[model samples]
Target: MATPILAQPDVDSGLRPVPVTNRNGVLEILRMRRDPFSFADEKRLRFGEVSGMNALGIRMVTCSGPEAANEILMNKDRAFANAPAWSYFIGPFFNRGVMLLDFDEHRHHRHILQQAFTPKVLKGYMDEMQPMIAERMTRFPTGKVLMLSEFKQLTLDVALEVFLGLELPKPEADRLNKAFIETVRAGVAFVRKPVPGGRWWKGVRSRKILEDFFYEHIPAKRAEQTPDLFSVLCHAESDDGDRFTDEDVVNHMIFVLMAAHDTSTITMSQMAYHMAKHPEWQQRAREESLALGEHLTYDDLASMEAIDLIMKESLRMCPPVPAQPRMAIKDTQVQGFFIPKGTMVVVPQMANHRRRDIFSHPDMFDPERFSADRAEDKAHRMAWMPFGGGVHKCIGLYFGQMEIKTIMHHLLRGYEWSVPADYVMPMDYSALPVPKDKLPVTMRRR
Candidate 1:
């Protein structure tokens, strides 16, 4: 026999029994993890609206509509908390990094971190990055085939140079790159444990190796201030005269590396794939890039409005961080339902970005939607959240954009690329959705 559907309860009672069936037992939770997106879709269809489910002994709610998502993510004080659930996945590796902090503590750390991303800082960063980009892109086989996996390596090298101030030797960089890949794979491992022979164990080991390497170099960097992000961060101080400890610096460095490198790599690959599929857009972007002449300056970055629109559209279609999860610190009410304390709330950017009401013809890869005439994303303040929203929104968003554009500009001018005609998109829901096969492509000089 089917479990009888319950009636919606009164809001005034403070314990409103909504029509949602509680199907969130241990088994169901495990099943959901097997395929998170399909699981979310199933829940949405059955419930007639998204609601909470108890999965893995945690009260979890998967929200879909714009209003519900905005309320939970934006209303930080009353509806949700960032630290509780995020810590479970990222805490072990990152350890009190800004992404895991909330409330006043979040604000304090963000203020200091913001210094590394200022206009003057970005100009310095670009100056440091241009030659690196030129050097790395030159290594690509001019008229030969390539895969995103290979390109991802190139981007990772750029990130190391820009973010960490460490220009890894090719051999050493390759070794660390392999370890980093394994480490990222471990983040989404279903059995989240560091037992022998586990991905988590490998990831934990890789993290230690990275930390030790960065720690050893910090003293030299501090002695002679360099024009790298690590140097800037090492000496940065809070408004209250507080300074980051050695551990703080290492943890934050690891966090920034993982966050910036992986997200940019995925996003850039997606951008390239889209650009290839739509040749006209690629030509337009190339023209936009060439308009600024041979050298790309800070002002030139701001001027490439067409590239910005295309990048925005790519992110909208395929966000690197598809879902943002939060846990309730205390019992709270959302849209008339009493959410119990400790419940895990998910605001899926994938779902929000594809919302039919907010975006017309949502599935189509149309950059024009972001153009001045269309401006579809402006429908809601929280509608287009590729970088997320609210207090915990990604701090490196602008920098990431600048980096992607800079890379795209150089590549569009230097090379022409194509992928297999039947290449299908694959989603890896673990850490973030990356193409399973590393997205194969062929390239030639333009």
Candidate 2:
């Protein structure tokens, strides 16, 4: 019988190996779930300095600085791959979507996905989105407290209709929302199984329900050729004459819906929080939006500079996707350490964005950091990557920016809002970072 040979632990000087004395991985998993950022923070503090070569049971390296993140993400041979871990977490649902594909397959899918995000397409999307924004804003209760959970729901509704041309009924939306929430929760679940009553089980069920719903609509949409994301995808063809199969369309549709809705909803809620905290900024945004008038054209969206700045700053403070995970495809060296193949490399956006060396008063929310004169984000091109960088950077960046700006333009112009002085922002970093309490605030007409 041969004894299992553990790799030599490469702890840096003055740093100790994270004690894995406890047999069950439950405590570590719980820490990861309860407060992921804090867990990372603790590791950094305790390890006089930590090395990616030797971190925990996973044999992982976590990079927090801008330079290190850039190296890992921008590598040309595609030395790093997203498939390993992404397949572990999101694969069951989003299998073969652009994000999960790598190399040539990734490039091929990206080309097709790019067509749906053309400037002309986005202009049309804005046309459909404005009325939805205006209608949802009109429904907000004045002088009464409202939970941003409701706001997230409204944005999800808009995202579904605008992106997929599906107007989800209230009951169906509610059920889907629960399923989505559970699916996100399951991403970090300790016990990764489809056993009864487990998060994974619920998520598996949720994915099926969504897949079934979307799959049914593809044929009808293909026949009609409606002018929406679904219709475009069904009809879209690659340069080689390749087209998405019905399953491909369904998976991509689910991916787009989650990407567009979840991130935008969190970002909108954060923007609203900032607005409530800073009445002057909120007022300025409102004034700017009002100047653009009630009926906002695509051209009008470009002129909402102040609103853009506010949203950018809010995202800087609380990015929707706080961390990105990649896997080492071959043994590689990063930051002077040898990271073995199969190691998980985490480039945490939240941690990197908070580096004082990159931004003055990194903790403070200041949109001026992005101003032409300061251009603090230019300190390092990769320093301000909220939507990620490299070939895998968000394909929907332009569309997302347009959707968020459009929503802000309408809401700010039509309403006044405030967060209670005691309001606290609680973050859950399980999947996308979102406010734990859903950001309740009071609203009234300006």
Q: Which candidate leads in TM-score?
A: 1
Model 1 weakest lDDT span, ten residues long: 1-10
| Tens-digit lDDT string for candidate 1 (1-446) | 44322334445666654344555465665655456656666777776444766545456776776776788888755557777788766666666778888888888888888888899998898998887887777777755454567667877877788877786788888876776777677756657888988888888888777778889988986777777888888888887878777877777787787788888988887888888788789989888887776678777887898789889999998898878888878777566566667777778777678777889988789999998898999998888998888888899888888788888888887888876677666655556777766766778887
The TM-scores of all predictions, comma-separated, are: 0.92, 0.91
Q: How far in Å is the alpha carbon of 424 misplaced in model 2?
A: 2.5
- TM-score, structure 1 vs. true: 0.92
Q: Give the CA lDDT, 0 to 100, for residue 324 in model 2.
A: 79
Residue 45 of model 2 has an lDDT of: 67
Question: Residue 28's C-alpha lDDT in candidate 2?
Answer: 54
lDDT of 2 by residue, 377-424 (tens): 898878899899999899998888888888788788777888778777
Give every collision pair in model 1. 24-54
